[model samples]
Structures are given as structure tokens and as C-alpha cells.
Target: MEGDLERNNHILGDRWESMMSGHMTRIANEKGLDAQNFRCADCTSPIGIFYGAPRLCWYTGEYYCQNCHLMEENMIPARIIHNWDFRKHKVSKRTMVYLTQQWRDPCIQMDEVNPSGYRYIDELKKLLPLRLQLATLEPYLQTCRMLTPELLSTRLKGLHHMLGNPHIYSPHDLCLVRDGLLYNAINKLVQFGTKHVRQCALCTAKGFVCEICGKDEIIFAFDDMTSQCQQCKGVFHKRCFADRCPRCERRHNRNTPL
Candidate 1:
């Protein structure tokens, strides 16, 4: 009986050690994976926290720097998945595959005017009463394509501050929460407009100049090289038309008697 008891105790001791060892190994592995997961796939650098949140690509289940994600101004990915705390599901390999396939590309192209992000069109129209005079306005609008929700908020805030007419309550005063994205988009639009808009196609009632290149020698006889918007009645260079006039296109697509 003594021998049996000693044998049982030895067996229990061995089992406990094995279990503890397994648990420790699992913990080590988990820590390693946690580090790996947050490392940027492109740069191999650990993704740093931006505004207290870790920067990561939501769809790919991988890390990416903010600059990589943005790529350029007004070119934000439509289905960019943010790793917000409010996310319904945690990103994993299986979820990433599913998301990638589901949101392969946006239904509306990037150059195409997204109706959802067109709240500023009316405001812009109000600001610029003499639309036909600014020959490059349409092209500038086209180049200033993206208006992410974050960007839209920034724009509204800027406009509110500039106008200062007490139209809306202050975000700070009201304790309203807002996304903490950098407002480079507003400046980006301003820069592009400043550089690109030199002439207007519709300013002169007679001959139209190419708003995109600022060249007056556009061959209007070729219907393909030059086209007029049905809604805004704005003429565009063929190459420019192919590129699209985002503002007029957006306005047309949104307010068309649908």
C-alpha cells in the first residue's frame, strides 16, 4: 500500500508538471504571435498607435502605417477596415479572407462621384455663385475626389470656424465625440485646386478651353475628345471627360429625378 501510494503521488507530480509546461509554452507562443500580428507587413516595423489606437489594416488582418493606408489625398480605400474597439468581430485569417473577397473593389470607381459623400456640393454651390467663371472649378472638383466621413467632418468644422455664424453647437461644448483622423484631406484639396485650376471651359459662351490641361486648342469636332454634361451643361476635354468631372457627375448622379 505504501509503495502504491508513492507511485500515485509520483504520477500526479509528473502530470502536473506536463500540464504546467504545456500552459507555459502556449503563453509564450501567444506573446510571440501578438508581436508578429502588429508588425507592418510592408515595412516590417511594428505598427504604432495613432491617436491611442493601433494602426492596422482591417480587411487583411495585417498591420500598415497610416501613410501606406492613405496612399494619397482623396484616394482613401472605400472598404478600409479600421480596428476600432466598436468592431463587431475581431480580425482573423478566416475573417480577412472573407472580407477581401466580399469587398474586392468598390462598386463605384474612385474617380466616379460617390453620392453618399456629396453633402458639400450644395454648400460649394452656395459659396461659388458664379460657377461658369472659374474654368478649372470642375476639374478641381474632379481631382478632389475622396471625401471620407472623417474628411467631411473636418471640412464642416473648418467651414463652421471660418464662417462663425453660430449655425451649430461646438463639439467641445456639447461633449460630442468625433473621430481623431488628421485633417490633411482639406489641405490636399486646396493644394490640388490651386495647382490645377487655371481656366474654365464654360466661362466663355463661345469656344471652350480644356479645363484639365488649360489648353484652348482642343478639337471639339470629335465628340469623343470633348463632351458636355447633360445636367451642368459643362464641356470637358476628351481625355478629361474620360478622367471624369467628379463634382458635376456627383451632382447629376445624386439629384437626377430618381
Candidate 2:
């Protein structure tokens, strides 16, 4: 249905033609919506809002393809409740978000939405407001595509850690982050035709570094990079690091086995 401005034009009688002209122009140029996009979930084409028998409800602000909120009124199922959660699903006892309520239509279930991680979550990705998903994912995926294994050890690993820093808006938006790091770190050498990208940061080990210290001391290279030492300032691999510092519980004045 058209808004007050458009409806008022139909009533004004005097300026109706000009008002109609402006309205048509505005409709033709709507931002992310054209007659061809996102489709009406039922008719497989686009038209705005419901004119059918109690069609889908566009709650929560965005036009959802799954919700089918813009179809004709007759096409809309009367009630939709989420069976998984009682709060979202009390529409009826059958309690399934089916495409229609007459018990004949196929249910639009979430299992069909793909249970894999975000990397494979295209249905969820598709549900993202169409205007922004490509714009957002494109640059991000491009950066992901350009990653050489060598740069991944530091760049990709840190990116994963930073996403979980508890400062971002939605930390869950990136549950795939740690996994992404591992994926990139593993496929990195293959993608760029290299050996190891990042080195173990703890005691100079062969794998990635420890989360404790930002050092590459997989073998216990002391200093500030490795874990704090009980020995002098000298850091060593966790196993090799001997407690010889002044605070050492095992330090003997004589030359001890340390």
C-alpha cells in the first residue's frame, strides 16, 4: 500500500495528477528494490507490499525472503511461531513456520538454512540485507583471497584474536574467526606455495606461537617476547626455561643444576 502522501494525492483532486507523477517516479527509483530483485517469495517476481489475503508480515524492519512479507494477503500464513523457541513460536500447536497454514504447504525450516559454519552460511548470508552483503563481503573476501601464507601467520592470526577482544559489536558474528585462522594457516602454505607461514611464538617451536606471549620463542628465547621468566630476564622455552631469577624458588647461591 502507498503511504499517506500518495493516498492524500488521490484525495486532493486538484493536484492529483502531478502528485501521482512524483509518486511513480519515486517508486521507480526505490533504493535497493527494483521490480526484479529478491522476489516475492511466492510469485517469483517483485511487487511492493501485500495486496493478497493477509500475506507475510514484514516485522523487524527488513523485507525477509523467508518471511514473504510482501506477497498478496491470501498467500500469507496466518500465524508463524518458532518451534525451537516457545517465545518465537506460539502461533499454534502444530508450531512450525510453514509457508502456508492450511497444512499442505512445505515448511520453510532452518535445517534447510544450512548447519555449517559461517563460511558456508550463504542462506544466512542471503538473508542479510541485500544492499549491504555484497558490499561488505566483497572487500573482505578479496583481502582473504590475497592472503599469502607468509603474511597469514601474523596478519590472519592477529585478525582472529582481535575479533574476540570483546570490543566488537557482535562477537558471534565471527565464531568462524578462530577456525578461519586455522583454515588460512593450514591452507596458507598451499595457497601461496610456501612452507610454514608463522612460527611458534613461544619457544621457537615449529607451529604457531603461544597465546600468552607475543614472542616467537617456541624454544625459550627470553626477553619480552616470551612468557615471563622466573630465570633472569632471559626467556626460554617453557620446558627449557629454568627459574634462576632472584625470585626463583629453586635458586641456590652455589652454581646449581639450573
Score each candidate by Cα lDDT.
0.38, 0.31
Instruction: Please give the clash total of every predicted structure, in order.
Output: 4, 24
lDDT of 1 by residue, 1-258 (tens): 999999998997787455433321121112332556666544555565632344444334344554344422211122211111122323433324433443322222211323332233333222222222223333333334343446545544543231222222121211111132212332344443333332334322334566667775633322235666556656677667764675577777889887
TM values, all candidates: 0.21, 0.20
Q: Candidate 1: where are CA atoms >4 Å away?
A: 1-88, 100-183, 199-232, 235-258
lDDT of 2 by residue, 173-245 (tens): 2223223433343234233322222221321232234333446434222122334443443334454334444
Q: Ten-residue segment with the worst summed lDDT in candidate 2?
A: 77-86
**Best model per lDDT:** 1
**RMSD in angstroms between candidate 2 and the native structure over all alpha carbons:** 17.7
Q: Which window of 10 residues has the lowest lDDT sum in candidate 1?
A: 75-84
